[model samples]
Target: MSPVRQWHDGLQRYGLVVALVALILLLSILSPAFLTVSNLVNVLRQVAVNAILAMGMTVVIIKGGIDLSVGSLLALCGAIAAGLASAGFPVPLSMAIGLVLAVMAGGAQGLLIAYAGLPPFIVTLAGLTVFRGLTLVYTNGSPITGLPDTFLVLGAGELLGIPAPIWVMAMFFASTHFLLRWTALGRALYAIGGNEEAARLSGVPVMRVKVFAYAFSGLASGLAALVLTGRLNSAQPTAGSGFELDAIAATVVGGASLAGGRGNAWGTVLGALIIGILNNGMNLLNVSSFYQLIVKGLVILGALLFDQLVVRRK
Candidate 1:
């Protein structure tokens, strides 16, 4: 390849990793606390939830689909798990029921998109509202507290001196990486995302794979819920509102193609870290939440523009 072409390819392949390193360095210079151990740990813990959600979002987007209901799914599942446990059900059983509900919700949306010919966006949008409503009904618009210590440990406890949520996030990221890099199902996801019709023609189980992608996304939301609930010591029906946007933003910023068939676990993790660090640094500088939102939006827009101009350009 010519030098220019090689340069462009390198930029596309290594851009996210480079950007994350640059971001960390910039933040460290701007905020003395940015590199402190306690602040770094805080960033890790705070980012764990979004990182987990982004992993799921990465998979769904890779399959040429979007799920706008994951935030609602998180709330509903978290509420169900925390609510039942608080109401005296066995903690483990309550969590399982909540996770099952999450999978069902996602599978239902996937079926609509894959088999019923409904658009993923519309189905998930409806689910966003519907699931939130179900959560309110289940909790009577109240937070669920008094969770058992055993269940809370999943979210709030520490293991190997690291926060539980961070561990959970790491596990999910590793699993996602393994799934995309080393499995037949991973190949199928790419094929379907690259071209659904062609994949079906090639004997890929396109519909089943589609369902699996969304279901996996749902499972991620449920796992995030567990950590979030544990961290807060309660589950609120209103929790996870707008979290879908964060997950999508992180996936896109991490270099995932919105047109599908491209993304990586490391990139998504770095994206989440960048966002988390960005917010943390801004807080250290006392930037207003309003300005933070604008800056963050611009950053995502920049990433999308770069993807279109450099990564996706022929």
Candidate 2:
């Protein structure tokens, strides 16, 4: 590749990292509290939920699909888990059931999109509303409380001086990284994303892969719900509202093509960290929450523009 092409590729690949480093530096200079160890750890903890969601989104998007229901699924799963625990179910069993339900929900959507010839966007958008309604109905528009101490540990406890959420994020990211980089299933997803018809003709098991992508997304949302519920020591029916946007933004900022066939677990994590830093820094600087939303919207637009430029160059 020419130097110019290499530079463009680097921008697509390392842009999020550069942005993150620059943001950290700017924030460190602007706010003394930003560089503190406690605050840094807090940032990681805050990003963990979105990072998990974005990793799953990465898989779906790379398969030429999306999952807008992730945020709602998170709420539903958390509420279910909390409700089960409150009703005397074992913490493990409660969590297991919540995850199972989430996966089933996602798989159902995937089957529709893959086999029933439904549009992914429409299916998941409908799911977004359905799951949110289910969450509200399940919790009667209230928060479930009185969760077990062990359940709380998954979100708030520290292991080896690192927050449990961070640990969980790290483990998930590592495993996902391996899957995307070294596994045949990962390659199949990329192929499907690049060209579904071609992938199917090539015997890539396109439908199965699509289903797996959606199922993985649900699994990630379930894990995020666990951490979120634990952190709050309760599950709010309204939780995770608008969280899907953050996950999508993270995936895009991490260099994932919105059109599909691109993205990495590490990139998605970095993107989430960038978002976490932005939110934390803005809060520390007393920036208006409304303005923060505007800023995030602009970031998403910028990422898309960058993706377009790279695509045109290619």
Candidate 3:
């Protein structure tokens, strides 16, 4: 590649990092509390749920698919965990059931999309409603509380001088990073996103990979629910409403192309941080909640526009 092209490519890859730094600097200037250690840690804690969700989103989007149900799936999974916990199940066992339920839901979505050849958008859209409805029905439109102390610790506790949620986010990111950078499945995901027919012709197990991708997405959502439930010490039937948009926004803002085949775990982390920072800064500045929604919408649109530009340049 020419030097100019190389520089452009580098920009495309690291642009989100630049944006993140710039955002931090701006926030630090605008809000006196933005740079404090406590506040910064707060940012990471706040972003943890979205970051975890984005990790799975990175995989799904890379395979040219989307999962609109993740937010609702989170509510459903979280409710199950809290209910199980309240029913005297061990914390670990309850959590395991929650994760298993999420994985099963994801795998079912994958089966439909892969074997039944349903459009991911349609299938997952249906899932969004179904999961949310299930959550409400399960919880009777109420929040589940009185969770075990051990379960609350998962959300409210710290580890080795860091918040537990941050630790979980880091571990999940590291695992996903390795999966995408070093695994054959990861390469197949990219290939399928780049061109499904070509990937299939080259002996890629497209259906299997798609199934795995959706399943992974589900797993991520379930994990996120655990953290959220822990943090809140309760699981609201309406929890995670609109969370899928934030996850999708984070993935795209981190430089993942909506068209697929272009993104990474690190980028999603940065994207999530950017979002977390934006929300934090706005709250500090007393920006209206309505305006915050507007800002988030704009960010998503801007990321989509940037993705289009990158595609054109290529």
Candidate 4:
């Protein structure tokens, strides 16, 4: 490639980095408290789960698939965890069940999409409703509260002076970064997303990889559920509603192609941080919740438009 072309490609690949810096500058200008250590840590804490989920979402989207059930699945898994704890199940055992359920849910969705040949949208859309209903039925439309002390600690407790969730988020990102950067399976994920037919012909395990992606998505949601439940000190049946949109927005804003095969974990991490910072900034500035909704939607649209322009230029 020529020099100009190489420079342009570099800019496109680092679009998320540019956006993140711009957001930080804007927020610092808009809010006097934006750059403080406490607020910065708070922002990181808030973005932890979203970032974790976005990492998993990046994998699926890179494989040219979508998962709309993540939010509902979070609520479902959280509710189950809370219910189990309330019923005297040991905290560790209860969390294990939640993880198993999450993987099973994702596996089922994968089977429907890959082996049964259903569209991913339809399969996961059905899952969205099913899991939402399950959450409500299990909790009887009420929030499940009074989780064991250990359960609360999992979400709200700190490890070595850092929030447990933050630690979990860090480990997940580090591991996923390695997987995406160094493993054959990781390369195959990109290849499958780039072109499934060609990847299959090239000996990629398309079906199994697809299954693993969805399963990981579910596992991420489950982990998020644990953090959320601990933070709230309860599991609201309505918790995590509409969260999938935020995950997708984070992935897209990170420069991941909805068309597939072109993004990185770090970009998604930055994207998730941007979303977290935006929310925190709005709250600090006392932007009305209604207006905040409008602003967020506009920002998402703008990001996609920016991405389109950059892609076209490349």
TM-scores for all candidates: the values are: 0.97, 0.98, 0.98, 0.95
lDDT of 2 by residue, 1-314 (tens): 79988887787777777889999999999999999999999999999999999999999999989999999999999999999999999999999999999899889999999999899999999999999999988899989998889999889999999999999999999989999999999999899989989999999998899999999999999999999999999999999999999999999989898788988898899889998999999999999999999999999898898888888888
TM-score of 1: 0.97
Flag regions of model 4 displaced more than 4 Å.
Answer: 1-3
What is every candidate's alpha-carbon RMSD to the true fold? 1.1, 1.0, 1.0, 1.5
- Per-residue alpha-carbon lDDT of model 4 for 196-229, expressed as tens digits? 9999999999999999889988998898898889
Compared with the true structure, what per-residue lDDT tens digits does model 3 show for residues 47-133? Answer: 999999999999999999999999999999999999999999999999999999999999899999999999999999999999999
Q: Give the alpha-carbon lDDT of every model.
A: 0.91, 0.93, 0.94, 0.89
Superposed model 1: Cα runs more than 4 Å off? none
Any residue pairs clashing in model 3, and if so which?
none
Q: Candidate 2 regions off by >4 Å?
A: none
